[model samples]
Target chain A: MVQIPKTPGPSSPAPRPVPTSADVARLAGVSRATVSYVLNNTTSVRISEPTRRRVHEAAKELGYVPHAAARSLRAGHSRLVLMPAPDFPVGPLYSRFISELQWALGRLDYTVVQFGSVGLHGDEAVRAWAELRPVAVLVPGAGLGPQGVEVLKGSGARAVVTLGSEPVDGAHALLMDHEAVGHCAGSHLHDRGRRRIGVVVPREHGLESFSLPRLKGVRDALHGTTATLTELPLAYAEDSAARLAASWRDLDLDAVFAYNDEYAMLLMRALQDEGVRVPEEVAVIGADDLMLGRLLRPRLSTVHIELPSGRDLAELVDRAVRDPAAAPETHKVLGATVIHRDSS
Target chain B: MVQIPKTPGPSSPAPRPVPTSADVARLAGVSRATVSYVLNNTTSVRISEPTRRRVHEAAKELGYVPHAAARSLRAGHSRLVLMPAPDFPVGPLYSRFISELQWALGRLDYTVVQFGSVGLHGDEAVRAWAELRPVAVLVPGAGLGPQGVEVLKGSGARAVVTLGSEPVDGAHALLMDHEAVGHCAGSHLHDRGRRRIGVVVPREHGLESFSLPRLKGVRDALHGTTATLTELPLAYAEDSAARLAASWRDLDLDAVFAYNDEYAMLLMRALQDEGVRVPEEVAVIGADDLMLGRLLRPRLSTVHIELPSGRDLAELVDRAVRDPAAAPETHKVLGATVIHRDSS
Candidate 1:
């Protein structure tokens, strides 16, 4: 037999047992059922405000928090909305959308959690999520496939909603196609007669999910055209932008689609410093019509992406959760349009 | 009695029972104990690679997942490390730091989950987090007090850490003071022979945790100095910035600290369009020393902030988890200084 040491630690004296509703009831001089009624606000039973306050105070004094697991079991559902953390740092627009979504979910009494998905991939990531047993999941990006959705459902998920370019076979889809953003920018540049275009693709990890689709869209738009497309790998650093700017003349690109406004702002400033005149020498465009785009000297032309309101998305999630076996609904969530400015 | 109405969800037939290790064992033609030994990689007992593969395959085929709660009970600890989601959109530096931290935690076999904290506050937020039963928590900002820490510890949290201006009474602290950033920016503007300094305070909610401290820091820096500080409320919108710029001359501010690089870029561009020359007529400075600031024509001066590496912070969390009874340690995580450039 393996013997355990007695000196468990100096700071943690024989640990006290975790307090329960009975502890609160004892402290409050009430029955356990009465404590529960006051705490849970059993509307059918009339509990005086003073008694409710006494129960709450007793619970607080004991540092007692109702166990979510126990509550979930009793309620026949866990009000959990799980999402995978983005593989990389997203821009402000997407960030704002997420903030809105979280706020709306909170209003609907949902507990939203973003799971770290750094080392996991594809169906494996889905498996990791299934272990969490969330009532609903809202996934972003194309990594989740039909098989992944099946795994979630089999694990007792009431709802599996995805926001990506294409719909997963068994999941409700929030169809936000990044390709449209790129296609709009490409078509706008083409209509303006800017050929020999350079597309600035971010060299950041996880951005490939968005960048690759956008690249494909640009390729589709410029197909059978006179425009020559060049893919430029650029990191979001001054040194990377400077190196690209130094080699801009040799590449001889007449125009540039610099991913989004953030990148466009970075690359355009570098090009301007390199004495390359905007629109005259090399027209530049970006996606996401952020206010920063308008602040540029040669104002940045951009693809303004309008996403579905967060309230609307929250309602969609609630509906899906209510009827898990309902037909997988697909909603187009992208409104990508070109906003012309001086740079292009 | 309220009979909770039940409906068989349209597509969901009577659900199958959740698969167990015994089910995997049956499918793999092995005993349950043998399956456990193989699947859990019990080093004491060697199993053939083929048997291990068979066990894994069987587990996968059966869609079996080990219950985290059951496993936690067996192991005497859970793998959960909880964090409150940022109240609003944070800058890139913080986002990258979070990603790195999550990756590091995952490497240490901890599952990191960011809980949405939209409408919760102080002790209320701590109670909500405790209900989820995270083994460890890393909170940012001053929302958590010593009482909250006690509540968390009482609820079985192995570690409680805070990253904010000051240390809480009973929690490990990652002491990152925004006041230092503001002081640096404020002192730099003062030293540059600029007075009547205007500080841009974002009107956005949740930013008060950062912005309010920064504003106070500026005020603290110029307490006895000849320079006068004016607080300007601004939203992150073109219209808001343009309005601020239209009345810039009337405000008669010769210098400004526009919160951070993003806001600095916005306001500077607006001021330039409004015919207020940068540095010559009105100097501008920001914080976070973002690459975007340097990409500006008159390179933006900024407060360069050095944050502790994610690996280091992860180590802190790990150590605290291991020895929860140890004295709460405080570490400074801020290195804020001014980087002079053309704009200032």
Candidate 2:
């Protein structure tokens, strides 16, 4: 027999192959089934505390973690919660909201996976997501149709939740009444003796779904009042702001509801650069009550928004996933109020 | 034998279950292997064009999609590129960078999954991330040690990339060189004929990894010059900025380099609110050269940063995944150039 030369190194047995649950079971002097029950915490089967501890310790020593795919196959479901990434500029407030949601989902022992659905849309997008067979999917911003939801359900997705302006027929919906936000800002300006108001609609694509409704709301609020609304399309660029600022005198307006705090700040600086005074010359208001707003000279007045607590959303997802056949439900997840400050 | 009563449905048929690859193969009058090859675009299999067309048509008619988890298990790897969520606040610049990265990865047929690693750290964090069996894991900001990298590699991770100040022994590192950003800002301020320079260090958790080195760089540049450096620890809050503004008289700083555009904008507003003059009294400089900075009354001076293009990073990830045994590589991701504006 030929003796193969061993690689020269520390004679430690070539680092042990990735240990398995069977290795843990053998180390703990128990059956693999018992190890599974203990490690997975299957309450249906009774096991002694000492035995459970032993199984856990053995598994730890061997660095044996059950393969997620295999475990998912046994359970007939993956512990993945997919959230479609929003294809718009996510401000600090939205970022914080997502962070909270991810943290809450993690605590529930669910892996939150962000599905980047940037270019894909409608049924095609749903099919791509369904291929993953995630336990649940949270679709925000993009509107999902009935057929799209059906495809996901047929593909074994237990819970399908949609967050948008209104409810979809098949999936659970978290309605965000963005129009109310615009109405609040517009009304505040009207009451403050501003007759002509400019509503800044960002020129970026994908925001039309949001900005259109906001514009309609502003118009709705100023319907009976003597105030008039002007649509000012602005892109998030210095030249855009400067160009708008350059024509500030021609488009005479008493106040402006610049999309959000970021836009508001941008326009405010441009207006100031053009020697236009804030509040005194043109009252300004924004939304998403950011702290930077407060630091502004004439502290930015804004429409404050409140989103549903992350725990509540997480709980909803879990409940829906557990009883997938249950009738779908809808809830309002956004509320808005105005924060009157120096700017307005 | 007992007879079972069939539930009454429109007499035609009830809804069919999700169609499988086998169903497509049967409908196409081809083998399941042919269907798999056609659907997955497998290059190794030489199937005639007519057969491929038949399989695809059958699949579209039957609405069949190969399960992601099942396919991953069969292939012994997942097409997932996991990026751990950064613990620190993600500013506009970083957010844009990540967005670009995600889009690029998607074009390369990789799903970018952001793993929430807010609290988890070290080996525990690595194990948690490994449970999903992602093909590649990108750890940014967080410092991952050799042991953690080993754990990931042992768990079947093909590539591990770290973005930080320095390269880890095992993982591929994308060096940020943040200190250069500070040195550039400091030198620019010094050269602008400003005697005293104050560098703002945000006292937010998880920012120390970035802020500390920036402080060091400022100190390094001010070594021989007859100038002074003061570290101002400010939280991202109105009160913090207001307090800092109140004490601005005592600090007597002629120039300030706030962490980045966000912080610079915040502090500049606070300073203005406190009746401080800009450029004449205090020249404020920032980093990231945001559009908002340009719109400022006295345009903000910034250290313009250049991040590696998304395509470049995506190609690196692909290369590393293709050849896991290649010597680990390091890339300089961040470059800086000072844009002196009205503020300085």
Candidate 3:
């Protein structure tokens, strides 16, 4: 199959001209301004139905699609909600939340865009986002500062929202307190009379934001109790889990909070293979409460994390967009509870 | 936290003017052209290092980031790679592949954007994408037709690459033949002396694209054989699986191909709870060979799917972008094989 070359573009003698509004106007026997109003669906303008039909027909004939970026720049405002793609594997739960958010935003007549910001960080990421001139920006996982919020506002972002552990100044905050997850798991294990406890900290990159807060919460929960917390750094790899399980007895930890269910499953398999009996020898608990966790041999215990509905968040953003003068709202958007099972 | 009102915008007694190149030039004591040259890093035009530093500092002090859309419009080209965010859960395997592709593209200086085309279909989706005027597009999982490719090419997309079941008319193709997965599964089960087989088709939205092809492949595989195939409609819910398992004896199927590992795990659990023995009463197999499948009791057999390396696909795109006149190239990018475990 032969490709239509892009090199001999609008330059080199123009085999086919990229049609413009002016071309549509010429064909429709109307002004370029009229063509613009008709094509853009400008509710503010008044144009005859016949004129609109002619303009559309001419556009179809010329294969013209109005450039969204150019039109947005001209209007000085856009219906764009920009989200920076997380540089981490956020798991299935968070993935579903994002899909919901995108769907809800579309219903509100806003275009959702996930900008690739894999290597970008802090204010550098903010500057990159600002270049797009998105009307709203949703910064995930709490690194946006007051200055970052100010810079985005200066560049015409109507709403700056942050969804993370803590609220940033001058931004709508959806506080997803991850600490509760760790606390729930730690307390549950401690109540089961396990003295020495271990928490799995994944060595995967970009997880430090979630892992550190969770680790801190576990330490806090077991602080005054006789239970001692051990930080076991494990990579999300089979060999790493196997090696950790190999030395499980030497560590003398009676119970462990193995990060989330995926890690728990990996470590659980390794421990069973090593002939360590669960609950009796070493109680294990996980977070996320995946369905597969319940299907495990010991019926895995887990911390069920509840994230705020995406539709609720979208409505909040819509409210902010309508009245940007409204006070920045901070909402508690996370809930964590321990589900007891045979594993603990 | 008080929000800075967006209503009191540029039209209002401006709180702070969104700084432009002119503002940077005024601060740096240079022409707008010189400021543009310095800030945009135009190596074509030589400037003193001190002058470049002055321009950068001036831009920084004024908090100016050149509008990406506006600049691209003026240049008639951009280094933007656009991908439509799939409207379905593409699973962890594809998610990793996407992350890798994004990283590789970013390294090559192209800004990747995932356009939210959640509800749009056919030429409507293509029109929405073309409005952004991306230099390249990587479409996934079949259905992009010849006319759709033409529309995208007409609207300044240099390289149109479809990564799906079959090559499109003019787009460079990455053939992800999902049919092989079902063929492999069907053949394996039939080889194990199982004739009455039930193939699980997930009753999930946006899955028909992959599921239908795989089902066809299975039908083709057991065409002349004594094996009779039954289409099983299964939802991704525990109740749905339980209902199917409850009627398992009545259906009298000896084996099942449960869509993917997740579905297989769900069904297997229900079957076990219903007093049915795996690989005896009902043999089960899944696709996408997840690690969790290995950890399951009696183990789970699965079809291993191999995807083309993101780096390799990225290189292919780069080549097409460089030479759009070249003939469209099609590469088979998916490989499927059976991993025989205890379940089957």
Q: Is the docking of candidate 3 incorrect, acceptable, medium or high quality?
A: acceptable
TM-score pick, better of 1 and 2:
2
Query: Per-residue alpha-carbon lDDT of model 2 for A1-344, expressed as tens digits?
Result: 11112122222122235567889999999999999899888999999999999998998777776777678867878988888888777888778878888888888988887877765778767887888778899988866888888788777788899888978877888878899889998899999999999999999988887788788878988998888889999998878999999999999999999988888988998898899999999999999999768767688999998887777788889878877766777777778899999998
Please write out the lDDT profile of model 1 over residues B135-199, one tens digit for every residue.
89999777888899888888778889998888998788787889999999889999999989999
Local accuracy of candidate 3 as per-residue lDDT tens digits, B271-313: 9999999999889999998988887877999999988877787
DockQ of predicted model 1: 0.30
Q: Write the per-residue lDDT of candidate 3 for residues A15-42, one digit (tens) a residue.
A: 2446777888999999999999898789
**In model 1, which regions exceed 4 Å deviation?**
A1-16, A22-58, A73-77, A224-226, A247-252, B1-15, B21-58, B73-76, B223-225, B250-252
- Report the C-alpha lDDT of model 1 over A241-270, residue by residue, as the tens digit: 989999999999989899999899889978
Residue A302, candidate 3: Cα error in Å is: 2.0
Which residues of candidate 2, in runs, are more than 4 Å off? A1-35, A43-63, B1-34, B46-62
Give the Å error, residue B168, model 2: 1.7
Order of candidates by DockQ, top first? 3, 1, 2
